[model samples]
Target: MNIQGHAALVTGGGSGLGEATARELARLGAKVAVLDLNLENAQRVAADIGGVAVQCNVSDPDSMQAAIQQAAAAHGPARILMQIAGIGTAKRVVGKDGNAAPLDDFARVININLIGTYNAARLFAAACAKLEPMEDGERGVMVFTASVAAYDGQVGQQAYSASKAGVVGMTLPMARDLAQHGIRVCTIAPGLFMTPLMRTLPEPVQQSLAASIPFPSRLGKPEEFAQLATHIVTNTHLNGETIRLDGALRMAPR
Candidate 1:
């Protein structure tokens, strides 16, 4: 479907890949809504893009529902949903003192990354299904964010890896389930990128991580991710797939 004149919802639009995506969508002439837990950040992006800003908690049913409603009120119902809001953690399953990893930590990651994705997709699908189908009977498209850690999680990444893996695992099934509703689902599992969190690391550490990628020898750009995401919407045949945007980089187990 053409992005021009369509309404789009971007979670985590406050910063990083989500922010880049929101800007790209707006640039493509889509009516964009920047949704994030941080209202100030969302507002900043929204103002710059001339889009709406919605404070949202992806894992909370009421919060997500309310956000969607608010966004729709501003920009009409959205046909594109970018599920990108998530958190990362590095916690060993067994600490140096030999205690088990806290269940809360694992739960928090799963709730936000995995369950939150489902929440956003389900809500978006429900609303999109009711919309008049566009070309090829397509009502909407959804792009989910995952990570290379899902496939090759290093040490101290059990919670983060598991949550992302769940997203990867859900891609095909969710796409199939939404097929009848005329909604497409796909995932992007990215490798090391220069996100805010990654930038906090020392320069040498960042360079070391970038060197791991075989070619280009640099971190993936947020705009690269945004480009692929928008392409998925335009390319109708691509569905139920998890495309790795990692520039031929398979992570090593640490």
Candidate 2:
């Protein structure tokens, strides 16, 4: 389970937590592949990290398969997978105008956040299962991203929360299924973090959000998340668990 000198794949590596993870893995001596929907951003991170950039749509079968193949072609088959690519939306089941929320919104979020996660994991696990086992019969490890909203969703977050909750739900079962292949699966349900999307909010709004955390009363850092993710890879005994990276912050209903 040592990360050094192994091949790793990070989806959504263009920005935010995924970018931080890609850099950290590279720094730790893993040959990293940065996979993202934005080729430009992926390339930027890949170049800086001396890794390969792949344009990937995790929800698309062909795109995800091609991306895995391309990364293997460059870095060899990856034993580490970081499933971070996802989208979010906030919509009430019934809008202010008295119309039911568009079904497309809910479907889109589920497709990207939930189904997309499974798509990437299945392809990665299939390939990793073929690799020779490392120490302790471990061939690979994968970390999935979820959110605190999955546990306590605010108003108008039906789609976003459901999608993330699905990820949280999948963790233990997926781990159990892959255990036979010497592959481990875990999830991280992060609280508020200073991601690109969060940065778009007004400063005052951001400050208010930060103050909501019970202690340390500030948004979580991307590097912190990355650190935990890398730790999960090295700690062989940890598997089938969902670690919450929230700073003791149970979100209030909005």
Candidate 3:
């Protein structure tokens, strides 16, 4: 469906891939709502893209419902919902200190990464479903972010990998359920991208991660992920698939 003049909502729009997607959608003339837990960064991106800023905790049903309502009031119901808000925590189930990771810590990762994505997707898609389908017989599309670790998890990534894997596992069935309404569902399992989380590492660490990539021997760019998202939005045939944007780099055991 043509997204021009349509409303779009991107969670985690404050930084990294989410921010890039929001900017790209706005560039395409879509009114974007930058929903994020970080209000400061959300407002920054929102103002920069001439979009709305919504402070949201995606795991909370109330937060997501209220955010969608406010965004719709301002820009109309979101026809495109990008579930990019996530947290990556690295901790072994059994640490070197011989202490097991707290259950709360593990649950926190699941709450933000997996459950959060579902929360926002449900809210956004429900709203879109109520609206009329587009000229191309499409009501909306949802793009979720997962990590390559979801498939091949490295050491110290039990929680993070499991959460992301959940996101991947849900894509097909979710798409099937939403298909009757002409809404598409898909996932992007990104490899060592140059997102804010990666940038936080030391330069030497960044280089080590870059060198780990098979071909280009570099980190992926946010815009590259944005490219995939844009194509998924416009191409109606592409659905119920998870595209890996890792430049041929299958993650190794850390």
TM-score to true structure, per model: 0.99, 0.99, 0.98
lDDT of 2 by residue, 60-156 (tens): 9999999999999998999999999998788989989999999999999999999999999999999999999989999999999999999999999
lDDT of residue 160 for candidate 3:
94
TM-score of 2: 0.99
In the range 1-254, model 3's lDDT, one tens digit per residue, is 77799899999999999999999999998999999999999999999999999999999999999999999999988899999999988888888899988999999999999999899888888888888977678899999999899989999899999999999999999999999988999999999889887888999999999998987899999998988998899898999999998989888898
Measured with C-alpha atoms, the lDDT of residue 106 in candidate 1 is: 93
Better of 1 and 3 by TM-score: 1
Q: For this target, which candidate reaches the highest lDDT against the unseen true structure?
A: 2
Model 3 regions more than 4 Å off: none
Better of 1 and 3 by lDDT: 1
Choose 2 or 3, whichever is better by lDDT: 2
Clash counts for all predictions: 0, 0, 0
